[model samples]
Target: MTIRIRTALLGAALAGTAATSAVAEEWRLNNFLPETRPETAQIEQFAEDVNAALADKDFKLTVYSGGSLGLKNTDLLRVLPRGAVEMSLMWSNYLGRDAPALSSVFVQGAISTVDELKAVLPVAQEIYEEEYTDWGVTTVGFVAIPTLSVSVFCRDEPIHTLEDLKGVKLRVWAREQVETFTKLGVAAQIIPQEETYVALKTGVVDCALYPALYASTISLQEVTKYASFLYPMASAPYTLGVATDKWESTDPEIRTAITTAADALWERTNQYDKDAEAEMAAREKLGEMGVTWGEDFPEADRAQFMEAVSETWQMLAEEAGGNAMDYRARVLEALGR
Candidate 1:
């Protein structure tokens, strides 16, 4: 009897172990940027926070940065719903093809500053959640980077005026950017961010519209000699999303923990944006790398550029239609425009 009782206890212990192992969940997060970028760092911090919060739960998050998983930025939304990826950090511009509404924040001349974008963030989140839900995903957080403004990084020459942009083969990402640049007589070329350095180095594109910080991140300063601070293009915001079914299956406590972590990430990102020393250090680093910074466009020139890009905004609003159109209206109203 003693021997039989001992064997039964051992069998029960093995079953419990197997059940616990089966219940454990591993989530994969895909980030397109290199580990050095602030965005990547923010996501990494988020993962750590989640892990710590859920220490008692059978949940673990693994982050794959620098596109190590071989998934492009554009592939994130498509794959996340299909279960190919559990989570992703994606840019709004990349989703413009299928969901133009999500990209409304990036409409040229529509949102001029980070503050204006923040003003509409609540509505933007709602809109994004609706769209993400439709596509079988759940949005957890938003990552916004603060910069002086989106600028033109040129290889051979500085684009100081509208005339200088004429006939320039500028690399563009979204359709709206293409329209905006085309109005200024620029030959816009849509290319992947990963391919930008080589394109700029090989003269495939004379200039590209990117954030000022990219000079250090992608070594754009090496290939591009001049950075032109142009019209105040809206910052391209990044979204954190998880597969809908996975999110639904998660325990309520675990979901709350993830939400709490996401809120902390938002606060951290906002503080990072407000840190002037960090911005200056990045700019100084770019200067040390031999990249010349052009003056901000003259007030009159800036006004003219804004006016020219207004048409692109109108086109995007019309193309977006439905919920996207409503979202843009909310954002514009919030901007007091």
Candidate 2:
């Protein structure tokens, strides 16, 4: 409607074209997130660097944001392999059915810190290469993401422990989430991202398991308050992958440029992403928004949750079949387990 809005839209449109155009080795990327957010912005910047690296070469990269390319969070793996999209920045957990092996990275209490987590990606990605290469994709690298601290934003009291979880209705994504919480006696509504805010406002769901950064991004500061640091559940991580066949088809210079740039970007962001200092700032901001963090759930409840969630790890491992053992073994070995 206004000039500023029109200009912003134009910029986004051009951003999408970065993946579509060029008279050479063309690759298209689709992201199901708004570029305004930190994660999405970083993705676009990666695209820019990739484009610059390919400038002299006959190769090109384009990025489509907000799912304009018709790929959902769960569709990238299938779409990428079938030649529908060449690359995507997706949460590998959302690719569960396509490659359930990925759940190991994000499952509750899988690994406690970023260093231990980053150590696992290289090997785990190899174990699941069949899942991606079968679809013509390969993992480039993973981001050291902020831990997925499951939040309980309610019009009710604070939920800080395992006992506090009973009878509570929470929101989740994967089927494993349903089983995990159900075992904890939590009723889960597997809802999409867009529906979560409304779900909270309507009283349809009272609890949500997401990262602290998301609370600020989605303006949850407006409604809910009091996030419990579900210790083991606090961290969640994911990777960025590209179509293997398509990637191989690119000019050598272009490929090297893209990978080198991505590596540097990942290495820098990985540490900064998991810095413990960020949490204190996040808590303070949320508090400023009128939400009070409470010690409603006690340490005993935390111990109970840790014990209960180990079963989920086993369930997830079972879901992955043989892939789990190899993936877990390598990560443990890397961590000196």
Query: Which of the numbered candidates is closest to the native, going by highest TM-score?
Result: 1
The local distance difference test score of model 1 is 0.78
Task: List runs of model 2 lying over 4 Å from the truth.
Answer: 1-26, 57-60, 118-121, 128-131, 232-237, 272-274
Every model's TM-score: 0.87, 0.82
Reference-based TM-score, model 1: 0.87
lDDT of each: 0.78, 0.68
Best by lDDT: 1
User: In model 2, what is the error at residue 113, expressed in angstroms?
Assistant: 2.6
Model 1 pairs in collision:
none
- Kindly give the stretch of ten consecutive residues in candidate 2 with the minimal lDDT sum: 230-239
Global Cα lDDT for candidate 2: 0.68
* Runs off by more than 4 Å, candidate 1: 1-24, 272-279
